[model samples]
Target: MNYFLMLSNSHADGVLSWYQTLRLEGRMCDVVLEAEGVKFPAHRTLLACSSDYFWSMFQDYTLESGAHTISLPALSSKGLEQILDFIYTSWIALSPSTLEVTLQAACYLQVTPAVDLCIEYISESIALDNCCFFANIAAHYGLSKAFTVSNSFIARSMCRILVAEQYKAELLELNLDSLQEVLAAEEMPGVKEMALLQLALDWLEYNPQSALQSNALLCRIRYSLVPPDELSRLSAIEPALCTPFIHSVVHKALNYHLQGPLQPLLQSVHTSLRTTNSKILLVGGGPEADRPQNQILAYEPRTRKFRPLSTTLPTKLQHQGVCVVGHFLFVLGGEVVKVDEESEKSAVMTVTDQVWRYDPRFDQWEEMEPLLQKRAQFTCCVVEGVIFAIGGRGQRGEPALSSVEKYTMNAGCWRSGVSLPHPVHGQACATEGTGIYISGGIYGNSPDSSKDVLFLHAFEGDAWQRRASMSIARFGHQMATVRGRIYAFLGMYEPFCDIEYYNPEQDLWTHLKPLLNDRFCYGLMATGGRRVLVFGGRKWQEGQEVCTTNVLEYDTEYDAWREVCKLPGPLCGTQCAIMTIQDPPET
Candidate 1:
């Protein structure tokens, strides 16, 4: 019988240390590695053990196996010296200035540990000045982690890198593939597509040798989004862009503007807005006691400016359910107020079952199949590509509806769905993942709003399950899901400023910071991360209801609210959605 004994990992480390000392002292060395007229003496067996390149070369079958010296002209002497030190001591020093040569030597010698070490250093050491260079090198060597980190850094810092005079040379250093990757990214914060187009054109001008790639580079631009005015300016100045390909592209964009209401039907890559171009759209709202405004206003948070789109709704609608599906905006059952022609000046508000779909691609609105039941003040949500219209009031005298209806694009028709536990109207509804949630609305014929919350696992079943109730009863309010949690904003009349959020996992509701001012019939929209925006609405002031233009933004992360900006006009009974539309020409 024999006992097995283990010498700890320190023994191996000691052996490496002893070998390193022997090589440094030029003791018992077997081979000499040379680069750039510099020679390094080392043990052949130790070099073979450390690198696959040396291991194969030292084999008996190889010409270098019998030789006492090996030449590595492709590698820098400094890089080889550093790599050899790491092989002996299990440590290496890397700096931005020498990273390229070091990584090159590691890759050339098939020293994977050193290669990974070099990659890690480059990833952590990326800076504005060297990020583009790192991206190029990592891309060249197919070093995925370094490539991804460097490209992400470049994209995030592009806004500064593009405008700063100091960074221009560095930006210009990006190769064709790297430049294309940077330009095509949608995460460039404030860098608009036009700016990217200008950058691409500048890159081409700077690198005249890349002129043959003009079409490939320029086509990444969403030409239709470049404002026809800018296109005209570019056409006049850039003789290089006057090619037939660019000319036709410009023509198509101008024609898109000409199409006006027909833009949706002619959707294309050139006409599609980047996700970064998404704006908060205030839909179908107007001054109190006035006809609902048909002209949808787009509110740009970055600029804090509002612009009304050229395309107006087919009808002025209020209390409508709005949802966006795959770039298409659907307006469901709503109250359409029109002037009573027989009564001369009086307005008649009629509940409509008509549905309309707005296609931003062409700025066109098309009437779709009517809802199964005529309802207003209902809530609609999309899940699994199907649209579900929930409880609402039907007509003027009819009681609030407990019935539900769903519409599918495949069927192209509305069908009945599972009824609500109780008829409710003026409720706030929102969806997260595959879950549909409705909370805080008046139940049937009751003047008081209910704090009850109901949920349905959409696509899984028709049953509605009761969840945690909200802190306050709300009506005509809005609900939005942000960061996987549902938030309820202020509604009408009672509990003027209370706001709350729900956590589905815990089935609980917690009060959040209330609004600075009390308002109702407003548009509530959630965008980006943990921020909810409240658009135009009506507020009670001096004993009279007055329309307000105030826009409030809530920061869930900080549990606070602040007035960011104001809407274009005082309006209420409106809905808002974040939409990617063509960018207007810059002033």
Candidate 2:
């Protein structure tokens, strides 16, 4: 009896023929054998050989049953033959798509090569999808090119996707403008509400203007679509959503939509009086003074004009601490020197602890109670009518002091408060809430400086904590707060014109636009609203000293700096103070 066996076409026919001969020659064949055009001799002597062979046969049956035959890409006769050979002989070079299919098949069959090919092909085509899926995959694989491509597509399509997808937090990684656009374009009724609520809470946390703008846009859309009664109901559901957008909308609604003569515009005369107009207070030495007594020049906001404040001091002053409380300006300790008649250079002079108060109403100066400790290069901040003096140099600039004292206007006396943890001079101080943040200043003498930024909490009781450090290690830089961000500008370091902005919440520092000229010991004062006035500091050019009369105003809203007015006279380190004066009520 002749028998035949089915095996892969790549197997040698001679080898299988030898096996068949060996099985037939036995007294009883231990293998099942069949030949071409012949049936198996089952009745004569039938035997199952190896279990491995039986399992292999079973897998072939399973694959045939489960195989999904999809149309393959059209190929030449040779290519088709090669593909068939690969299936029958298990040897064929694969294309990208074919490799994906082979990989899927291999995974089903527990084949390693096929699985590897699939991963390779998917990696190469990472930029193929709309980026939502591929971006996630790229992030997993740590493929930078894939990430770049996917990020680009996700940013472009972010607006069109439903807000539900955005809530997944994966979309938060997108740029703020893209998120705003998506929130703005969403037209579904509840979508705007959800978007606004999420964005408003995010704004409260992140407080980016873009997020706030998104909240405003959603509020507008909600008002337009929902009825008045429904609007009230929705706000009741989410009170937080209403509060963030309300401040902006209330002002707009009151000015544009309300009727009747505007009720005489109850112009916040006192608040306005409390607000300072944008003006430059030029502080420097006047040419006529017997000594270099500190003097101030003022610039008008509306007319772009300059006026000299009638107030004058004893001599040319440097490193004075100035703070404004209501309409009264307090000028604290500063160093004064007299020019030597023989040498024509400034010589020994007195460093005074004299606290001088200047009233804008009288245009005069009055000597107040002297500070308990005479210090120069100190920083001052006014909170709740109490002036807090922090960090300065002691008499003769020998001992740097870390002492802090509070001057209460009610008692008309100076009292010791909490001292800073470390010594600092020429520090930038700004008040926020109940806390005062003091940033980058010089601690030790010349050639040895400190770049550390510290935050002192007097309300918390005598503890000074570290906050974010400035980008550049600098001293004699002017610090001011605008819209809740701390700005440090024009220090005496190598790059004298740089400006650094610190965000207290994020504990991060970002560089702002540089100054037009180098400035040292410059004056920086907030003008309320959106403007900050920066004035008089000494500038250097080719070993020659030029006292700067240049006045520059910074607009936070526009992110711009512009030259407002030039001082009439040379002013450097004059006792500089700023006060907001409201025009008197009309009769």
The candidate scoring highest on TM-score is 1
Error of 2 at 150 (Å): 69
Model 1 residue 220 lDDT? 70
User: lDDT (0-100) at residue 76 of candidate 1?
Assistant: 94
Q: Each prediction's Cα lDDT score?
A: 0.83, 0.56
To one decimal, what is the Cα RMSD in angstroms of model 2 from the true structure? 21.1
Alpha-carbon runs more than 4 Å astray in model 1: 1-7, 236-240, 264-269, 276-576, 580-587
| Candidate 1 lDDT tens digits, 11-36 | 88999999999998999998899999
Q: What total of clashing residue pairs does each candidate reach?
A: 2, 11
Measured against the true structure, the TM-scores of the candidates, in listed sequence, are 0.58, 0.50
- lDDT (Cα) of model 1: 0.83
